[model samples]
Target: MTQQELQQLVEQISLEYFKRPFRHRVVINHRFKTTGGRYHLADHHLEFNPAFLTAELRTDLIGIVKHELTHYHLHLLHRGYRHQDRDFKVLLQQVGGSRFALDVGNRRPQAKKFHYICTNCGQQYHRVKRIDTRRYRCGVCSGILKITTKM
Candidate 1:
């Protein structure tokens, strides 16, 4: 959707749900990598991820809008606006907004993991934590395991 469309939608949702008119700006931000939307405290503008613009995720888009609106409205009124604030949580739930942003687009790669191998069967295993080689055996072959790489 165009920037104008996004602005209209944000304004509509704010008025309908929060019963408050959004006096600032709303813009689509393609650079948002992990979050669905963000509310700027400095300027009171709302930035939304463009990935949620698909027709299939219209509800998700609405939820994101409400989430950001919660921040916008609360901050404007000098109420609790941070995520940990009771007022923010209450308002977010009242609006039925998403508790978390939808994951869209490419995410950062996972941290390096431990790579182990079964000495007898050559089967490999990836684990987030280091395991005791003497106690833990290969699930497939029940063979002794050895760490091959820290990654």
Candidate 2:
């Protein structure tokens, strides 16, 4: 969806769910990497991740909008607006807002990769988790293995 559509959606959700009018602006934030949306305290503006604008992610987008709106409305009312607050949790659950953003694809960071080599057969192996050098041996010749590098 476009930025204009996102703004309209936020306005509609605020009125429908929070029973309040959204006077601040809402924009699609292209730089958001891990978060679904953000509610700025200084400017009272709402920012949504542009990646969740697809048709398949429509429900997720609405959930994110509700989550941000929860923050927006709570903060404006001088109530507990933080995630750890009881009012925030109660209102979020009441509005059916999602706590965590959906990781649609392989967007999360990869684990550390370790490279191992054998002394006898010179066989190389790459693994995501670290392996014990004393317990683990090379598969080819059962030779002693040592970590070569970590990436």
Candidate 3:
């Protein structure tokens, strides 16, 4: 969906659910990861990840909108707006918003990948950091571990 459509949807959801207008801006942010949407406290703006715009993710998109809207409305009303607060939890549950944004397809870039193999069981291990084989043994059969290559 376009930015304009997102803005309209935010406004519509705000009015329909909160019975209040969304006077702030809503934009599509490509940099968002882990979270489908975010509510900016300083500017009272809403941001949504563009990855959830596909037709297959329409349900997720609405849930994300509701989740962020809960934050926005609660903050605007000077209520408990943080995720840990009771007001936030109650409203989120009432609105059926997603508790956690489902990881769509975004992945954090790994600096380096390490491949490890066990001598006995041949069990493989993939890690982002190098490990000393002597210090750590394979959990399968207490076998000696060796670093194979960078994957």
Candidate 4:
């Protein structure tokens, strides 16, 4: 969809879901890599990833829009707008917005590190703690496992 179309959709969703008008601009931001959308705290503008306009990502696009709208509306109303806040969570759930921004890439938790590889199948694994390669075999190929890296 075009930028104009995105703006209209945001406005429509804002009124429909939040019962408030989205007075600020909504723009398609190509620079946004991992995040689906972002709400600017200073300007109140919403920036959405253009990749989300594709047919396969339409649902994600809507969710991102709703998520950003939650921030916009709550911040405008001087309520709890942060993700951890109760009001934001309740409004987000009510609007059926995504609980967290969609990570386009594999966004494993930061605490996770130990990387394992299957010797037979060449399959990779990520873990939070080191696993015993001697005892464990590849679940798919039943081959000896090896530690590839630690991150």
Clashes of each: 0, 0, 0, 0
Instruction: Please state the error at residue 27 of candidate 2 in Å.
Output: 1.4
lDDT of each: 0.90, 0.92, 0.89, 0.88
- By TM-score, who's the top model here? 3
Can you write out model 3's per-residue Cα lDDT over 65-143, one digit (the tens) per residue?
9999999989988999999999999999988888888788698787658989999999998889999888999999999
Tens digits of per-residue lDDT, candidate 2, 1-151, equal 8888888988999899999999989888777887899999999999988889999999999999999999999999999999999999999999999999998663666675999999999999988899999999989999999999988
* Candidate 3 least-lDDT 10 residues: 104-113
User: Regarding lDDT, does 3 or 4 come out ahead?
Assistant: 3
Off by over 4 Å in 4: 105-151
Ranking by TM-score: 3, 2, 1, 4
Off by over 4 Å in 1: 108-114, 118-123, 127-151
lDDT of 4 by residue, 28-108 (tens): 888877788889999999998887888888888899899999999999999999999999999999999997666676344
> TM-score for each prediction?
0.75, 0.76, 0.86, 0.69
RMSDs, each prediction? 4.0, 4.8, 2.2, 6.5
Clashing pairs in 4: none
- TM accuracy, model 3: 0.86
Say which candidate scores most in lDDT: 2
